[model samples]
Target: MTTSTTTPLQRWKTFFADRSSVVSGIITLVVVVLTLISYTGFLQAVERRSGVVFVDSIHRILGPIDVTWPTFVVLYASLILALGVLLTRPEHLFRTLRAYSILVGIRVICMALLPLDPPMTTIPLHDPFVALFTSSEHSTLTKDLFFSGHTATLALLALSMPTRSLRIVFILSTTALATFTVLQHVHYTVDVIVAPMAALLAFVLNRGFAAENQ
Candidate 1:
């Protein structure tokens, strides 16, 4: 009798061949896409409405500095790195997607409940890539506050990383992004401060749901 062993390629093939995995991935993608669409529309409406603007001591200290390009560089670079690592494990990618979708959904709800106006010293963060996809009228949004999406995104990535070293790297990246967002006055101190906690909550909830299903 001859024994056969599965190669890495075969394992990947098996993972893709699984009907459940494929269906789960498709559903996750659809949910994420729909959530993002709703988020964008909600933000546009929020921008049109007037809201309260409170004085933040941290923003007063840091003032407003335009670090838009550097902010996007760090944000997108960390995102690309996280995707590269997560793509190696399809299950991890799915979990991350589910967690992120939940995070964005939470943000949408929070922003709706807490209508915040942009900081007095606000410097608009102009993202070139966002500009490419969005019209000029809606590209530069300033009122999507109460929680910083940039900070939370990096924090979630840090939490989702499988290895300690990567986690540390992403944690530091999260801190840097938080600082950049504050320095640019794109978000308030409270927004950045609350972001990591929100991400942690989302990650924990997603893991708990996964455990229950298992």
Candidate 2:
């Protein structure tokens, strides 16, 4: 049988035929928006009330370590690639996205309660990245210190993925990124640990929500 062309609205309705698909998509978007709000608020609060004295103190101890630009770039690239690949299947996409959302939300909650400063600002490191991390205008978003956001995001992406290979890649990429964060003095040992913990907590919440909905 020949098919007649459908209008854009009709096509949209057909595409979202499953109520679950549409509802999940909306819920996912809501979760994302909430996380963004929490993140932005946490950063602003920290910038207004805190200083870099603690980070400066830590820098005195870690200033001797040297990290190259190329290494940091490679680590960042690997992290993006791993997360990109895992976020692709439609079947698990919403669930995975929600998990990521929860992870960021958790981090924001932690940061709001316990704002930690990066070593660069507190230590007054001379590195370009350090300056960026420490500057009030530039560092506002990056200075929230409950955990490494990138590391936790990478970890959540990996943990929520179903495939073993993807999980392995996620673990490897997150580890590399976390290592870079610590070595670069962008985050502390506690932040690295919290990244995985945040992901784990998100995963648990995601699973519970999914089951309840089912």
**TM-scores, each model vs. reference:** 0.91, 0.73
lDDT per residue, candidate 1, 1-214, as tens digits?
A: 1112544455457669998888888999999889877777777787789988999899888868888888988999999999888877677788999999989988988898999998989999987665553557878888889899889989999999978999999999899899999998898899999999999999999999888976
Q: Pick the candidate with the highest lDDT.
A: 1
RMSD from true fold, candidate 2: 6.8
Instruction: Tell me the number of clashing residue pairs for each predicted model.
Output: 0, 5
lDDT of 1: 0.86
lDDT (Cα, tens digit) per residue for candidate 2, span 34-96: 776665555666767764425434445654344546345655575567556544444456777
Highest-TM-score candidate: 1
Q: How far in Å is the alpha carbon of 212 misplaced in model 2?
A: 1.4
- Candidate 2 regions exceeding 4 Å error are 1-15, 51-87, 120-136, 139-142
Per-residue lDDT value at 110 in model 2: 82
- Please, what is the whole-model Cα lDDT of each candidate in the order they appear? 0.86, 0.65
Which pairs of residues collide in candidate 2?
52-122, 55-122, 55-123, 56-122, 56-123
